[model samples]
Target: MHHDVPLIATVAMAFVLAFAFGFLANRLRLPPLVGYLVAGVMAGPFSPGFVADAALSAQLAEMGVILLMFGVGLHFSAGDLMAVRWVAIPGAVGQILVATLMGVGLAMAWGWSLGAGVVFGLSLSVASTVVLLRALEERNALATPNGRIAVGWLIVEDLAMVLTLVLLPAFAELLGGHADGHGTATGGGLLWSILLTLGKVAAFVALAVMLGPKLVPWLLRQVARTGSRELFTLSVLAVALGIAYGSATIFGVSFALGAFFAGVVLSESDFSHRAAADSLPLQDAFAILFFVSVGMLFDPFVLVEQPLKVLAVLLVITLGKSLAAFAIVQLLGYPVGTALTVSASLAQIGEFSFILAGLGLSMGLLPEEGQDLILAGALLSITLNSVCFMGADWLRERGRARFPAWFDEFGKDRQLGLQGQLDELRRKSQAREEARSLQITSLIERFPIFADLDQAGREDLLMLFRPRTAQPGERIIRVGDRPDAAYFITSGTVLVRVSGQDIRLGPGEFFGEMALLSGRRRTADVTALDYCQFQTLEQRDFRQFVSHHPELRQKLLELVRQRTEMNRQAAAAQAEPVPALPAQG
Candidate 1:
């Protein structure tokens, strides 16, 4: 019925199936992106469904990439990237080189030209920004050190790809064994071409620096003052799209790169968060469309027709790239968890790969089969990357439990081993002290008992605390014991047994305070259920603190009374007691 309206039909089918598959994927505890790809497949001409307009879908997907990169630039800070620069820079470049070599090797074995191999290899070397960001966002790891490393690594790869895209055509004859209609570039010509490309890129950067800071912020401010949310959102879109198109048309920069710069320029403004929030829905919608567009390009028959070849490509993309990344990260003295996260985040290829392959085919450097194989590889790797993350996490946890001795044994035994060991010990000690201080400060800020204390007072109180750790099943406090200390949990879980009742406490929670304030024996037993880290305040320190701050005594007395009433109310609200479980040793 809607056949005449191809664009409308396509958009409608894409969204409808995307939602259906997204819901199904969610039910199965998978990323909804998987479902969006499936929706694309269903709506594609290859499947027996209402075929969507592939051209229109691709254009919309481009918008998705623009918005997605813009959002990433908004959250990404130079400081965060620099924090992991040592590992990220070398690691990303090294991994790309390794992956490219692997791809070239594969292509040579398949009897393809070196040019085709370079393009194929380069395509597979870079990870998809969308996929990596989505994975990190899902795990809530985007702000973590490892996430920063992964993101920085991605930026490096993108830069490398951009350079490759610029240089490939100039060196086509040397690589492909034949030149296109354009005259072959001599050595001098190649050098000149490279220099020209760099000049243009530098000019773009210069332009951005000159105008972006003042102009972008001013435009956003004007839009903000209009008191119209719609106008503000429209302005953000206009800037993103306008800059992207301008970069591509005038500066020869890619749309994704342009949009990223636009976002970076806007990020300096105070309204950046608001802009991000406003653009989120559109960003998400287009992102799904982007995945769908990629899916529509996939031909499922490749898996059946060239099973071994496709499998080999997938292995190179998923395992080859990941192993290189993992090795590079670990070699830099980062923890196994960080290495795993970085590696898993990069075990797939996407947008850039498609672009590279398309260009290669157009230049007659790549075969149709090469493009098909690349697409198939992208699909398989994206699918398996999710499992790769789960596997890495599992391995990390297993390593922590099974091989603690071997974990910290690396990156030592150099000429400065003694100094390095001393420095390591100092860092660990400082970290522990800082953790305890933060825990104490948080407790002071949160509880009514310490509410009267100012920030300085809390800082003074922090000195009375010391860090402590307890293994699972260890008894930290026993009922009826007169311990002259109070404990506040900093990490992990503890089980509290009181008057035949069991209560679980987690980080920032306190115990032994009631007994300390009441001047009596402990009323409950506290036992660690996991590897717990906490802070302990000793009786002597507490007494000294009270002596210096006499007003705290009155506040403490009032807190004790309030706690007593609350505990009484809690007990009254409890149901009939169940049989007590046997205590763990």
Candidate 2:
């Protein structure tokens, strides 16, 4: 059954295979990228010839990487990254330097050529952009101080990538010492080649930025008008691939860079979030292809023959990058602990590193086996990074001391309201303890009462209202002697009987305020409707707490006057009605 297959058939085959592997990866709690890589390996040169069109696969994979980077740029806002520029700049640069040095040293010891060692070492310094951003978003940490610093640091990495993309090829070509440098078409000689490369980058960025605003937004607006998800997807795909091609062919720059710039321009608009949500499926499809293409580059034989070397390289990528990032963030003035914790979020090889290595191998800077090592290293690092993201909360809990004060309640500013925040958290912590205590009969929460309260206010309120829970049939309050305290229903319902007339009251509906405000005895009886909960505030506590929020000075008198008038009218009618009835009789 082995026969020639058309390009379409092979591509369709890759998609189906990619999906199946991605599904398995999810079930195993691993990153889908890993599965895609694994799928590519199975279909690669060393395995069965499921895909005969290597060139076509490579093209689509290139598109996939560009789109992935573009998506990254759109998701991040420049203002957010700018806030932590001071720390992010030096921290990211320092990590890159340290990781590269470690990588180069290890590669040299493993008998890799100086040129290949340089390429491999630099690759180790690169962290997975896809994984890092995804991890930050998942943890709701993107808005946290730590997340902000980490994202700024990531931007530094991306800028470095741009420079690296330009320089690495130049370095590799120099290493070959051959005038042709593996036959990459040069516009002229060495000077001309360097100038052309630099010019392409400049022109591509300038043009893409200038035109992207008009083109991308308009295209999306049209797709949005159609309201067809399929069209939106197709438009997204065309934008990514079309722009990538223009950069590579016309501008003579890196397509990845073009895609990234395109994303940046589009990010400044309102539709950025919408674009991210709607086009996610398309990105996933191509990104999987890109990852699998990376895996296909890995050679199992290389790892087996040099397990120690392979593992060492992997170690340098993971631990060395992590440590360097941690140290750098501290040196940049962030607390040592916060820096290290954030660095853990970025200690992996990125998808773009493989692109660089693949280009290096084709251009003769890196050996094929070195490429294999990179592919495997990327897989291991990405897998580990995903695990790190998944368990970050657990990690933070266990190693809270090692992180910044920013994660703690005391670390941040007083924006969320101190007493209220702490009290809320404490309540959540002791929910079970406060669940069954019957010291208080009734409880209620009214937004109006808490409108002026901060976290501290809530804590103060909790102090006033000793919380209690009641089972069904538990009597909460009785209309009798002067009520000692007013009940606030925190949750559940209660029965209210005013002069034996029943009225149902639920959460947020407070009764007995009339007695408390008027200095009168209880006018109604209240009882829990079901398994109920409440917080009771004593009369003295209510006065003290309420005075601080809005001192009763004049408003309290007004409220009292209104209540008195209503009660007087009701009482007069009740008394006079009896006389009228007697006259009628």
Candidate 3:
């Protein structure tokens, strides 16, 4: 039967499955990349209902990988790359070589052919940019030192991987005894292929650059003038896909590479973020499916059969690449923390692994096992790369902890000289909430309770004021309940009922301070009957704060004393009868 399933049904099914797994992964806090991979495994040939058309799925995945690479290129500007190149270049290359060598050595030891060994080694050496990028974003580390280096490393790896994809077929064929190292006219043929590919690449870049700057910007300007979002979206897609198709058809280069260059060129224009915001969501969906397709290639049975080979590859992926990257970054004059962290983050096989494997299969450089191995490595690499990256942070802290004593006096002491400059920037970033906290603490410290504290006590108090959210109808304080914390509303409102009388408070009004100051039960019942947010100072923090600020304590004591005196005055006034005046009829 040559009948085919509708594209919508197939793609829809894949998406539904991807969503289900993604949701599950989210619930578990596991990476959604793992979810997509698991989705593929569940929907694959080895599973119950095999619905994937390998060729169709693979073609879609190819498009996805291309777009993903393009996305990477788009986010990373040349300036961004240059800033972190020192760490990225050596870290990425070092990890790749070490992992590759480890993979090849393991294969040889396990009696696998040399060609397969090389392919496996190379494949396992790269990490998943998709996973790493998402993880970095989640951790708010994307703009941090490690994130920049990580992105740079992956960009370099992609370039290297693409080059290897171009060269691997010939290398493998030579090693596999399928062809002479040099063929008759091989020199001419090879040179011609190289020149043609390069010429097309150069031509595409030059043409796109020329056309993109003038044409794209002009078109975008017109679109902006008209203010049609739909048209703008269509135009962006057209630009991306049109450039992609033209490059692929004319030069025989991967559409993915073309899209990447297109993004880079577009980056020079003003519409970059706007386009990215609109288009990246689309890219993310397809790219996830692309990962799922890679999972479709994984056969656990094969790995089980070749368990030794798999384990060996895993070792190379983890240990070999880590060491390789560390050595390279250290050699490049980076601090040990940056060197190790950057190295660990980049140590794994990635998107280009599948790209190379597919190219190799088409060119006869790799057999079925080689392709499968690459696929497995890609999935596992994504899973573990993030783990290694997390370890990199820990390793960084350790490196600083072990920072040389004199490095502080000569190297780091100089950084301390800029403490004022950094402080200025930090103050700006601290925003209003942080500024408020600082102001309040400074005021509190002027009181008797906190006046005696040293610098460290102030630092400890600063850690207690993270923003908190409250649900409608949630009680901030229940009258007569032991108050373990003090609530100061930063925004939103709360209803206070003291002795069955009601009062309302809005921003900057504080409650439970009496309890906090006196270590007593809440005097009022306060409830948030609407969406609200607030900050609470914990009991321990309150006590510590009071202890440190003696003046503040003395002031609070005086206020409490006044409150008691007022209660007595009220009682005495009540005891005295009110004088009544007679009115004339």
Q: Give the lDDT of residue 383 in candidate 2.
A: 79
Best by TM-score: 1
Each model's backbone clash number: 0, 11, 22
Tell me the whole-model lDDT of each prediction, alpha carbons only.
Answer: 0.79, 0.69, 0.68
Instruction: Choose 1 or 2, whichever is better by TM-score.
Output: 1
Better of 1 and 2 by lDDT: 1
Give the per-residue lDDT of model 3 (tens digit) for 1-585.
754665665577788888999889878767777788888887778778856777778878977876786677667567656656655676677777877787788768767677777776777777767766777787797766556667778888877776675455445544562423454335667566567667767777788777777887777655543334567777777777777778789876667777777787777565776678767877888798787787777776767787666665666666777777777765665556555556666655667777766665665555777677666665666667667777877866665577664223332332343333434544554664477567657535433344455544544344445467778899877878997876666668888776445678776666677887877777778888677766667776666566656766686678767755764675576678878989989
Best first by TM-score, ranked: 1, 3, 2
lDDT of 1 by residue, 1-585 (tens): 545887777778889999999999889767677788888888887889588898899888888878887887676566545555677789988998999999999999999988889988998898888789889998898756567678888977876776676567667766753345766667887688668767877888788878998998888766554445688799999988898889888877678778878888887565676788889899898888887887787777778999999999999988888898888877877767778888898888987787788778878888878888998888778778889999989988898788875454543332134334435545765786688577666776545466677654565455446789999999999988996787878799999987567889988677877777667898889999999998787765665566556788776677678767766777876855778999999
Worst 10 residues of 1 by lDDT: 410-419
Instruction: Give residue 516's error in model 3 in angstroms.
Output: 66
TM-score per candidate, in order?
A: 0.67, 0.64, 0.66
Give lDDT tens digits, candidate 2, residues 288-375: 7787777666777777887887788778877777767766655554554355557677767877688778777776667787888888
Off by over 4 Å in 3: 1-4, 110-118, 166-185, 398-585
Worst 10 residues of 2 by lDDT: 436-445
